[model samples]
Target: MTVQTWTFVIVGLTFALYILIAIWAKAASTKDFYVAGGGVSPLANGMATAADWMSAASFISMAGLISFMGYDGAVYLMGWTGGYVLLALLLAPYLRKFGKFTVPDFIGDRYYSNIARTVAVICAIIVSFTYVAGQMRGVGVVFARFLEVPVETGVYIGMIMVLFYATLGGMKGITYTQVAQYCILIFAFMVPAFFISFQLTGNMLPQLGFGGKVADGTYLLDKLDGLHRELGFAAYTEGSKSMIDVFAITLALMVGTAGLPHVIVRFFTVKKVSDARKSAGWALLFIAILYTTAPAIATFARTNLIQTVSEQPYASVPEWFSNWEETGLIVFEDKNDDGVIQYVGNQEKNELTIDRDIMVLANPEIANLPGWIIALVAAGGLAAALSTAAGLLLVISASISHDLIKKQIKPDISEKGELLWARIGSVLAVVVAGYFGINPPGFVAAVVALAFGLAAASFFPAIILGIFDKRMNKEGAVAGMVVGILLMLFYMMKFKLGLFGGGTKEEWWFGISPEGFGSIAMLINFIISFGISRFYPAPPEDVQEMVESIRYPRGAGAATHH
Candidate 1:
């Protein structure tokens, strides 16, 4: 079968499976909508959490970034994986014990202030939207290639599909669907790796294959480094980023992972605090399977791309090249009117332009893998993007409907009314998400990294202080979050988004890239929070007691609304 035909079959089947699961697990009450009725087993929640955590950033873009960025890309690997550990160990159990459906719910009740809750709601909406933009873009990228549709049309399709399941079954549907997604994505991710690994180094395990000898009896990394040097690029094994930037980016991603609202809300779906902890462990294990394989895939893809394209005649290039070229991701200009390709690193001599996002998607084709394998990757990419998009959309809707409308503006609203409002909010969010998808600010991993920075800057400080500091008051938490998020927005706009007339890399604040500036902003938030807290009265006595109560171990109990 042709790759497109296989894609239609696999992708169509997976989509049908997701829709069926959503129908089977449809939510009938507020609890079901919010936290899947808080009865999910640890194993199921763990698989669902892994699917939610991976995102398009992990399944599609992480390895692609690594393939192009080489050594510097390790920052993403370290930051994201390290961040998950931080979240599981430091935040998940306590937040589960607090028994809240959303981050704002915890912030509001713990701080004993509706105003604080409102601020948290705004932060949640902003962060979730920024993250979902990357997911939507991932969806568009896959469809544009496999389905041969315009990226705009792909975004619209993704928006409609996500809206159907996300709004209809809410978290109840998303959780079960994610479990199935995890299986498909993991299978899709690994099969190609295994095939390519054996083809290159006679090893079925990709993790070891990249380190093993290639056909010429040289280590894969050593050969890549040789290729890079020959092409006037830096050695593949050496990093170009400064130490401070790497450290800052890693810290930012770690704290940001802990602060992400959609990921945190998964912990609330479990039955008890202990269950949350158990699920966290299970999730980390499941996540490691792909994380370990990514570097190998990146290495293999980079080597294959260079070997297959560089110096090859335009007419003689593989069929995969022409297919991707039609999508405009691969451009061959035939510089100097020579028949041979010039894929050198130097801009002046380079004749081939490749988008880094295409490396993973294009890998199986480049290596001449079977058609079914290529199609399976397309389905995996969609599964990864849709699963996380659903999760983020749910957070956006819950922030508005549960945190803002029910808790503040219309405290007397009935459960059914709130559910209706939540669905309305989800629909609105999908429209906005689709817009960002069509007008994406950057590539998938880059956009996602910025969202992590935003999460780190805005939510990390407030949540940590709210949980651990008994004296933390609403005035300080609210002020800190506003300042932190604004500071992050300013930096991202000026540097990342190229606002404020756009500055050069040399002009970055204290030599930090916008992606790493979150660490500085988070530090300042901690400072501002502490500095202002001394002037205000401590939290109310009962609030402080609630904080203390959350700190201790307790019997396993269902998540609560109080």
Candidate 2:
């Protein structure tokens, strides 16, 4: 088949597969919709959670960012994967024992306050919405390439596709669909990495390829660093970011990963607290495969681009580079009228510009992989984007219908009415998320950046302390969430948007970037929450008993339909 034909075939088959799963696994009640009947196997839940995590950011952007940032990008590799350690140990099992359908449900019941639940619901919605927008943007990128349409139009297409599965099958549909997603995405990712590794370094293992000698006999990274300095760029093996900033960013991502509502909700779907713990182990194991291979891919892509394009005649540039040029992802300008592309660090001297986000998407074409492989990648990217979008939308809808409306505002709401409202809420969220995809904010470089910070600031502290600290009261939990999220929003708007005036990293508080500020903001949340408990009354006796019970490994049961 032709490239376009191949793309359509693969992409169509994947969508059909997801639709079939959604139809077969359609949710029957609120419990099924929210937590997949709370009986999913540990292995299945692990695969589902892995799919939720190996999102647009992981599949598309993380390796791409590392391509540009060199060792500075280690933050993402460590930060994201490290959070599961915190999750599996510090949070997931305990939350699973609490026997709630949602994170807000835990907060609400633990604090014994409707107001705390409301605050948690709002945080979940905001974070999930922010996260879904990024996924929509990823879908737009894939659709734009395959359908030959504007990215905006493609985003709307992606939104509608996710809306159907999410509304029809709810959590049950999303979980099984994600299992399929894990297979497709991981296969697509590994194939290209292996192919490129063999072509360049005679090593099928991308991990070994990074360390192995190339045809020229110099170490690959050494050659890359040499080429980088030759082009007036920093060494590829060394990081240029400040140490403190790296520390803060890594810390923020770690906590943020543990705190994200969509991820936390996955543990709730498993059959028991033991399953939650085992599922987390499985998740980290699977995630590590991709994580370990990414740095090698980043190194290879950077080296290949420098060697292939630097100082080459513009007229002689490869077909892949030209193709991306048409998409505006790669740009070349002959500033000196020499008709040659001088890709130096300085824009005045460099004749080519490449967007970092396109690194992974364009890698196959750069390596001259087969058409079917390229098409498979396009399908894989779509799966990564759509699966995560469906997961996030589920949490967004549940937060609005189940947590906010049914529990707080209309306690007497009918089951059918609440499920209907959940579907409606998903439509609204998808539409809003699509809008963000079309007209992205200048500062929203990666969806993971903003979403992680917001999650770290708002939910991480409240949930952690609520689980461990038996004395944590409603006032403290609510106050911490409100203060932390508002502070994060204030910083992001002030610095990222330049709302009041121009903002830059130079004006950052003690050199902390907005992404890293979440770590500090979370600290303030911990302090304020503990401080509030001193003046206010403690959690009720029964609420304290609930906290104590959550610490145990036994007695996990399926959450009933409200």
Clashes of each: 0, 0
Q: Per-residue alpha-carbon lDDT of model 1 for 1-562, expressed as tens digits?
A: 8999999999999999999999999999989999999989999999999999999999999999999889999999999999999999889988998888999998899879998899889989998989999999999989999999988888999999999999999999999999999999999999999999999999999999989999999998999999998998778888999899999999999999999999999998988888999999999999999999999999999999999999998889999999999888899998799899999989999998898888889999999999999999999999999999999999999998999999999999999999999999999999999999999989999999998998998899899998889999988898899999999999999987688898999998888898899999999999998889889999888898888878875554654445
Error at 115, model 2, angstroms: 1.5
* Candidate models: Cα lDDT each: 0.93, 0.86
Worst 10 residues of 1 by lDDT: 553-562
- What's the lDDT for residue 273 in model 1? 85
Please provide TM-scores, in order, for all candidate models, with all chains considered together. 0.99, 0.97
Backbone clashes in model 2, listed as residue pairs: none
For residues 1-562, could you state the per-residue lDDT of candidate 2 as single tens digits?
6777888899899999999999999989988899888888999888899999989888888888899989988898888988878888898877877778788888888888899999999899888878887888888888877667778888988988998899999999999999999999999889999999999999999999989999999999888989988899878789887889999999999999889988989998887677788999998888998899899989888888888888888888898887677666677877899888889987678777787877887888888889889888898888888989999998899999988889888999999999999999899998899998887763123666878989999999999898889988889888999999999888888987888675887889879988798899899999999999778988778778777777753435542222
lDDT of 1 at 1: 80
